[model samples]
Target chain A: SAVISQKPSRDICQRGTSLTIQCQVDSQVTMMFWYRQQPGQSLTLIATANQGSEATYESGFVIDKFPISRPNLTFSTLTVSNMSPEDSSIYLCSVSQRADPTGELFFGEGSRLTVL
Target chain B: QQQVKQSPQSLIVQKGGISIINCAYENTAFDYFPWYQQFPGKGPALLIAIRPDVSEKKEGRFTISFNKSAKQFSLHIMDSQPGDSATYFCAAAPSGGYNKLIFGAGTRLAVHP
Candidate 1:
C-alpha cells in the first residue's frame, strides 16, 4: 500500500491560467495515474505517467492541455493548461504495486480546482 | 470507453441497517474488481475488492458479492453507521493490462441516525 500526498489541496484560478498539481507517494510504484472526477460524474483517466517517458493520455485528453511529468517511481506532476470553466473538478493521483495482479489503486487526497 | 456502470445515484439508509451498492461492467476481460469510498472534498480510498474466482468475499463489516456470469458485483455494508456515509465507486481493470482503471458512476450513500 502507498500513501500519496498531493499539494495545494484546493485552488481557485482565473481563466487562461495554468496550474500544476503534484503527487508524492511513500513507496516506489510501477505506475502512476492522473484522473479527473468532474462534478457529479465518474472518474476519467487523464493519462498514465511513465517514468522517463512521455505520458500516454486517453483519447479525449492531450498532453498540450494536461501535461504530465514522472521524474521517478514515487513522484509525478500534472499541469492543467489554459484553464477553463469546464476544467473545474477534483483531480486525483493514484499509485499501484507492480507485483499485484489485481488493479488495486491507492489514491491521494485530491486537488480541488475551481476555474472562474 | 467507460466500461463500468453504477446505479442509484443516491441512497438513504437508517443507522443499524444494511447498505448495498451495485455495479455492472460490460468488459469480459476485467478480472479484478474493487470498490472505493470517498468523503466530501477528499480522495477515494480502497474499501474492498474481489476477484472473479469467488462468488463473494467479506472483510469486517464490508462484503463484496461478485457474479462473474452477470459481470456484476455489489458492496454490502453491514450495520452501517452514520459515519459510513460517503460516495461509493466501483472499478474494474484487466489482470494483465497496464493497471489503468475504469470507474463507474458513484453512488452517494447517506446513513441517517
Candidate 2:
C-alpha cells in the first residue's frame, strides 16, 4: 500500500480567501481521489485526479470552485477557491494499492480546513 | 438523493458487546463495499471490505456482512471496547466510474469500558 503524506494538515482561512492542499503518495498511482468531510457529516467525493488529464468532479462540485492539479502519478493538489464557512471540512487524499487487486484504497491523515 | 443510506446515526455498547452498523445502496452496479473507522481528527481508515461474490468477511475483531440480493451491507464489531469508540462509515464503489466511492452519512459509536 502507498503511504500518503498530506500537507497543510489543518488550515484556517477567511471568507473569499483560497487555500491549496497538497497530497504526496510514496508510490506511483494512476488515480488519486479527493474527499471532503464536513463536521459531523459523511465523506463526499470531490473529484478523481488522473495524471495528465482534467479531474472528473462529482455532482454539486466544479473545477472552478475546487481546482485540482495532478502533476504526476504520485502527487496531487486540491485548492478551495473563494472559500466560505460552508467550505470548512476535513479534506482527504487516497490511493488504491495495486497489490491488493481488490480495489481497496488507503487514505492520508487528512487536512482539516476551517473557513471563518 | 443519497445513493447510500445508513441507519442509527449513533450507537452505544458495553465491553464485550456486539456493535453493528447497517447501510443500503441504491446502485446495483456497485461491486465493492468497504467500511472505514475514523478517530478524532484522523482520516478514515479501511476496516474491512467485501465483494458481491461473498456474503461475509471477517478480519480479527471486525466483520463485514454483505447481502447482494438486498443491496445492503453491514459491519459488526465484536467484543466492542472503549478503544473502538469512533465514527464508522460505510461506502460503495462501482466497477468503473473511476471507482469513486459513495459514502454513508456515518455512524458514531461509543463503547463503554
Candidate 3:
C-alpha cells in the first residue's frame, strides 16, 4: 500500500496560464503516472514519469503541453502549460509499487483545475 | 481506440439489491484488471482487482469476475446501500513496462435506501 498527496487541491486559473500539480508518495515507487479526467469523462493517460529520462506520453498528448518531471522515486510534478478552457479538468497522480505484478495504482486526492 | 470499454453509463439500484458493472478490454496483453470507486470529490480508490490467472476474486461485498476468453470482467456489489452511490471506473494495465493504466468511461451507481 502507498499514500499519495497532491498539492493545490482545487485551483481556478485563467486561460493561457499554466499550473503545476505536485504528487508526493509515501514510499518509493517504480512508476508514476499523470492522468486527466474531463468533466463527466474517464481518466486519460497523460504520461508516465520515469525517475530519469523523459516521460512516455500517450497518443494525442505531448511533452510541450504536459511536461512531467520525476526527480526521484517518491515525487513527481506535472505542468499543464498554455492552459485553455478545454484543459479544465481534474489532474490525478497515481503510483505503482515495485514488484507488484498486479500493477494496482494508488492515486492522490487529485488536483481539480478550473480554467476561466 | 479505447482499450477498455465499460457498460451502463449509469445505474440505479434499490437497497439490498445487487449492483453490477461490466467492462471489456481488447488488448490480449493486458493481464491486470482493477476496479476503482470514486466519491463526489475524491480520487478513485481500488475496490478490487483480479489477474487473468484467476476466474474470480471477492472481498466482502465487492467481487470481481474475470473471463479471460471473453476478454471481459464485471464488478458485483452485493447488498447495496445508499453510501455506495458514486462513480466506478474499471481500469486495465499490461503485465510489465511502466504500468500505465487505460481506464473506462466509468459507471455512476446510485443505490437508493
Candidate 4:
C-alpha cells in the first residue's frame, strides 16, 4: 500500500487565479493520477502524471486549464488555472503501487477548492 | 462504450437492514470491478472488488456480486449501520493497463439508526 499526502486541504480562490495542489507519496509509485469531484458528483479523471515526461490528459480536460508536473516518482503537482465557479471542486491525488496487478488505487484526502 | 451506469441515485436504509447498489457496464473489455466508499469531506476509499472470473467476493460485511454474462455487478452491505452511510461509487477498468477507471455517477446512502 502507498500513502499519499496532498497540500492545501481546503482553499478559497478568486476567479482568474490559479492554485497548485501538491501530492507527495511515501514511496515511488508506478502510476500517479489526478481526479476531480464536484459537489454531489462522482470522481472524474483529470490526467495521468508521468515522471520525466508530459502528463496525459483525459478528454474534455486540457493542459492549459489543469497543468500537471511530476518532478520525480514520489511527488507531483496540479495547477488549476484561471479558475471559475464551475471549477470549484475537490481535487484528489491517487497512486497505484508497482506490485499491484489488480489496478487498485489509493487516494489522498483531496484538496477542496472553492472558486468565487 | 466506456460508460458504467449505476442505479438508485440515493437510498435510505434502516440500521440492521441491507443496502444494495447496482451498476452495469457497456464495455466487455472491462475485467476489473471495484467499489469505493466516501464519507463527508473525504476522498473515496476502496471497499471491495470483484473480477469477472469470480461470481462473488466478500469482505467482512460487504459483498460484491459480479455477473460477467450480464455485464453487471452489485454491492451489498449487510447489517447496515449509520457509520456505513456514505456515497458509493462503482468503477471498471481493463486489465494490463494503468487502471484508468471509468466510474459510475455514484449513489448516496443514508443509514438510519
Candidate 5:
C-alpha cells in the first residue's frame, strides 16, 4: 500500500481560472494516474503521468484542458486550465507499485474543485 | 468493446442482509476485475478484486464471483452494515496494462440499520 497526499483538498474558483493540484507520494511508484469524478458519477481516467515524458491522456481529454507534470517518481501536478462550470469535479491521484503484478492502485483523498 | 456495465444503480438493504452488485464486461482482453468503494467526500478505495482464473475470491465479509464465460462478475457483501453505505464502482483492465482501467457507472448502496 501507498500513502498519497494531495493539496487544496477543496477549492472554489471562478470560471475561466486555472488551478494546479499537487500529488506527493510517500514512496516511489512505477505508474501515476489522475482521475476525475463528477457529481454522482464513476471515476474517469484523465491521464497517466510519466516520470519524464508527456502524460498519456485518455479519450475526451486533452493536454490543453488538463496539463500534467510528473517531475519525479514521487511527485506530480495537474493543472486544470480554462475552467468552466463543467470542470467542477473531484480530482484524484493514484499510483501502482512496481513490484505488484496485479496492479492494485492506491488513491489520494482527492482535490474537490467547484468552479462557479 | 471496452465498457464495463454495472447493474442496480441504487440499492437499499437491511442490516445483516446480503448486498449484491453485478457487473458485466464486453472486452475479453480484460483479465483483471476490481471493486472500489467510496464514501461521501472521500476518494474511491479498492475494496476487493478477482481474476478470471478463479471462480470466486473471498476477503472477510466481501466476496467476488467471477464468470469468465459469461464475461460477468459480482460483489457480495455479507451481513451488510450501515457503515457500508457508500458508492461502489466496478472496473476492468487488461493484464499487462493494469493502469488503464475502464470503470463502470457506480452503484449507490444504502445499508439501513
Candidate 6:
C-alpha cells in the first residue's frame, strides 16, 4: 500500500469560489487520477493526470471546470473551478504503481468540500 | 449511462455471518474487476480483485467470484465482523488503456454485533 496525503481534509466555500485540493504520495508513480464522489453517489473519474501530458477528462467532466495538474510523479493537484452548490463533493486522489495493463489503485483520505 | 450496476444499495448482516455484494457490468472490454472498501469520510481502499481468466479469487476473509459469460462478479466476506461494516464498491477497468475505473453505486454494509 502507498501512503497518500491530501491537504485541507475538509473545507467550506461560498458559491462561485474555487478550491484546490493537493495530493502527495510517498512513492513515485506514473498515473495519478482524480475522482469525485457527489453526495450519496459513487466515485466518478474526473481526469487522469500523467507525469508529462495533459490530463484526460472523462465524459461529463471538462478541464475548464475541473482542471488537474501532475507536476511530478509523487504530487498532483485538482482544482474545482467556478464552484456551485452542486459542486460540493469529496475529491479523491489515487495512484497506480504498476504499468497500465495490470495495476491497482491506492487512494488518499478524500478532501470533503461543502459549498454554500 | 451507468457502466457498472451494484445491487442491494445497502445490507445488514450478523456477526459471524456471510456478507455478499453483487455487481454487474455491460462492457465485455472490462477485464479487471476490483472491490473497494470505504469507511466514513475516508477514501476507498482496494480489498481484492480478479481477472476474467479466474472464476474466483480469495484473500483472507474476502473473496471475489467472477463470471466471464455472465459479465458479473460478487464479493463474499466470510465471518463478517463489526469492523467490516463499511461501504463497498465494485469497479471495472478496460483491458488496455489508461486504466480508468468505472465504479458501482456502492453498497453500505452494517454488521450487528
lDDT of 1 by residue, A1-116 (tens): 78899987999999999999999998889889999999888899999898999999998999999999999989999999999999999999988877653446778888999999
Q: lDDT tens digits, residues B6-58, model 3?
A: 99999999999999999999988787888999998788998888889999999
Write the residue-wise lDDT of candidate 5 on B1-113 in tens digits: 98899989999999999999999999999999999999998878999988899999999999999999999999999999999999999999998877777899999999999
lDDT of 3 by residue, A11-96 (tens): 99999999999999999998889989998999998988988899989999999999999999999999999999999999999898
Chain B alone vs. reference chain B, TM-score for every model: 0.95, 0.95, 0.96, 0.97, 0.98, 0.96
Better of 4 and 6 by DockQ: 6
Candidate number that wins on lDDT, 4 or 6: 4
Off by over 4 Å in 1: A99-103
Model 2 chain A weakest lDDT span, ten residues long: A96-105
lDDT string for model 6 (B18-110, tens) is 999999998888888999999998899989989899999999999999989988899999999999999999999888642588999999999
**Candidate 1 TM-score for chain A:** 0.96
Task: Report the Cα lDDT for residue B103, model 2.
Answer: 91
- Enumerate residue pairs that collide in model 6: none
For every model in order, the TM-score on chain A comes to: 0.96, 0.94, 0.96, 0.96, 0.96, 0.96
Model 4 stretches astray by more than 4 angstroms: A99-101
Order of all candidates by lDDT, from best down to worst? 5, 4, 6, 3, 1, 2
- lDDT tens digits, residue span A61-116, model 6: 98899888888889999999999999989999988888654677889989999999
Measured against the true two-chain complex, the DockQ scores of the candidates, in the order shown, are: 0.62, 0.56, 0.61, 0.62, 0.66, 0.69
Off by over 4 Å in 5: A99-101
Name the lDDT value of residue A76 in candidate 1.
98
lDDT winner between 2 and 3, please give it.
3
Model 3 docking category: medium
TM-score preference between candidates 2 and 6, better one: 6
Model 2: pairs clashing at backbone N, Cα or C within 3 Å: none
Where's the lowest-lDDT run of ten residues in candidate 5 chain A?
A97-106
lDDT of 4 by residue, B1-113 (tens): 98999989999999999999999998988988989999987778889888899999999999999998899999999999999999999999988653688899999999999
